[model samples]
Target: MAPDPLRSATTTDDTAAIGRLGAVLAARGRPGPVALGPHGPHLVTSVADTRRVLTDAEVFRFPVDVTRRATTGEHAMVARLRPEQVARGTRTFEAELSRATTGWDGGGADDAMEVLRLPVARSTTDAVLGPLETMCRDHVADLVLDWVDSLAPIIAATRPPRRWSRARREERRARTALERSLEDLRVEQPTVSAVELAAGVQVPIAAGAWLLVLLAQHPQAAAAARRHDLAVEVAWETLRLRPPTWVTARMTARSVSLERGTLPAHAVVLVSPLLLGHLPDLLPSGSAGPEVFDPQRWVGGDVRPGSWLPFGAGPHACPGRSLGLAQLTALARWAADRHVVLTEPARIDQTRGIFPSPALLRCGAVPSSPEE
Candidate 1:
């Protein structure tokens, strides 16, 4: 049998093949949590299986050839904020999030949500990015969105370092923005953390926007999210349905089987967080599981351990997840208690990095419900 060309670019949706990936996991010699396929065999899917692979670096590895090449000379940028750096930045980020939505009287919350979303980029910039963190919300957000925007075209096109020039330009712009922020590092940098420094803060800041987008989708869910009730669970469900990264790409470390069959070593792997969340073993009753949006499941131990990897697993998990969640919880908690309506429905594009950015969410103030 010949491999299908549909799954070539993990960044692009080439076919409906993803819908049938679960059956592949259960078939053939593939067992033990990992499943390799004739088409997308490179990816490792099981929660338990991935736990093993992620924990054991020697057996599995993320080929950084592309990442390294693309990130050339950016090591210092990454190393600047050490573990504490990431922690402190998260703290600073958290404080700001708390400061933003504090003392709300539950009146005109829908309007407040809209106002906040409109200026989110700049507000986020103030927290993470330095001075270049433009106060102009929409345009600032546009700049960030534009950079990720190039991702699809880059992957879809053919040419060696073909997208190199474009990528470099984006990097240069980002670097320049960082350089501006660096000028006042002593004063501006004290609160800065590794995540802020490494990700330029905007990367992680984007999570808030995403949660807002999802909240807009389900009035009830958004209300639940706003109250920060079992926020972690809500966050997990959001990850399941609208994962930041629609697909995860990893370079094979050694020739291995998907608990199923033979697969070549060093193969490019695509693990869909979207697909992983739907596994029956992990989900009590599939995607429609009772705890699907219930945060209580996690609190009551109904939640499966090592089964969810919204921030991902292993060395590459998103470090700023805590900060993102904190902000999300506060926002969710606030919104749920008030009368809110997402006036401007968000337009989302998942083709960006595994973490897709919601391009827009126009908000309008609405009267609070009588419950408030």
Candidate 2:
């Protein structure tokens, strides 16, 4: 029989492939790690094993060659943004988001992906570039967005595109443009800034977009989010349900013994936050199943919000996690009282990290008072 398009790992729709993979892994009955194919990466489904893979840098190392054009010395140049930098970025993000949504009140449908770009990009640039003039900051932000856009095809392809292919050429063009623009700014480390800005902006945009879509889809959850105290919970739930960085991979530096089996040297290991989020053992005990989107499950706080490692874990975890969460929480608060409804169903786009395709929402004011 022919392979099912949705379940085939080689299917062009990466989103379906991932969804099918998760379902298959979950169907294995126990939370044990499993190999994908004869030589494919070992998929770590259990929280314990996932954590072990992420934390044990010695055994499982990051595949630095994730992309075709790998750079050296970049890691040495990158540093986490200071507290003050995060604060500045948060302020900028809130302000930019407000500006972007000014006319959204009861307005026609707006594409969440399109509307979220400026806020995320500008805020990331502010945090990384640090104290740039307004005009210069916006220019750099635009360049960063352009570069990120150009990288989609290159990053999504199963195999690296030919160096001279249009995808590669476009990616190079985008990267060069952003790098040159950053260099002109005389930033402390232009290359580092470029990397930081791209990493910071792209993920947050996908996350914020997902948050909006979830809120729109779950009216009860959206209503609960109106309470300032519940806004963070709403953000957590969004990440739980639809984390943008759903699946990540690490390479085994040497043979490692797992609870289920031993992986040989130079094997690839996969950890999926999306799959882990579905595990009942890892979530708060509740009447609603793990598949349900109930933010109230976290009210008692018995279980932590990040057990599934939405932003990842250990040293290599996302540096902008705090800022990313803050941005999502702010978006949740903004969406709380609004009657935001999806214009159509959102299909997952897995080209570069999973994101909602055409996450279009129509916004209107909710009733001020409940009807008697």
Candidate 3:
């Protein structure tokens, strides 16, 4: 096979390493899975293989945590988020975001990631934490955000930090604090609630920030999305181009034979929605091509939005998928009419899950609503 042209591009841009990796993999012109190294850790790029690797838990297992072995035997359960909860969360996010952006007047720039943290945290808290006094709910939401922040260093490290390291210590402190708070509230399964709140709050904040950055970069799409229906389409396109959870990993439970090749036991396997989103066959053909951002390709609904598995697929898929989509759609609607402009070039931050770094934007004056 010929060397991919994107290989050079990948090396030059440190910020977009993950994205460039996906691009290079997609450009290889292979119809099957590709290996990252001769020894193993293969990349599953094709749609069928991606689905098979993620959906088959027996053969491909989630990475085992030796520290959590005590709870490993418990059957993992995913709580189904109710429709009413999603609706309530969406409303809460919109209101919170409106409050967060109140002072913008195109006079100064704001970091999208920083601006979005509390609103996303509070919105997710309201949806998942159940009824509580307003003050109590807000306090819990704040604690969750603190816990999420403390986790960044631990997650971004090349290897697991030592138990006594500063990163690990900070994370332990945050987790203990949040767990105690949840217990005080009489929440069932405090450990589970902590995990849910962290996942629910953190992922959406990254997603929402990306939506704003993409909107600011693509004014034409933003203008078209002024219509509510088009805004929803824009949300789908943002997720397609840059799903926060861009890559996921699974370990082979035992030696297995796949259509493409054979893998030894305990080999690490990877699946990436980012790479799948770049495949021409998986997306609708457009004048601009799959690599370009064009929301109109989804107009006729010819190709389903999630064929690339943005939120993932199968039994282990994100349980808060509906609420996450609703939150992003609401954000798209809010940004549609606003003249949001980037103050600086946004770089991809892949230390943890991918997010926009220094996602600074200047907003124009808000237009009065139709009812106003």
- Better model by TM-score, 1 or 2? 2
What's model 2's TM-score? 0.89
lDDT string for model 1 (1-372, tens) is 112112321224543233434343233234433435565545555565555555445545554322133322121121232444334444444555455555433333333322343233333444444334334423444444443333334443344344358665665465445444344444334223322433343333445555555555455545544554656665555555445554555655677655445556766555555556656566543234522443334544644632657666655555445544544555555445444444453433333433323233434343353233
As a whole number from 0 to 100, the lDDT of residue 234 in candidate 3 is: 78
Clashing residue pairs in candidate 3 are none
Error of 3 at 97 (Å): 0.7
The regions of model 2 sitting more than 4 angstroms off are 1-29, 64-77, 368-372
Each candidate's number of clashing pairs is: 21, 0, 0
Instruction: List model 2 lDDT by residue over 171-237, tens digit each.
Output: 8888889889877877777766677788899999998988888777666666765753588888898
- State the lDDT at 32 in candidate 1: 36
- Candidate 3 wrongly placed segments (more than 4 Å): 1-15, 18-28, 64-75, 227-229, 366-372
Candidate 2 yields a Cα-based lDDT of 0.77
The best candidate in terms of lDDT: 2
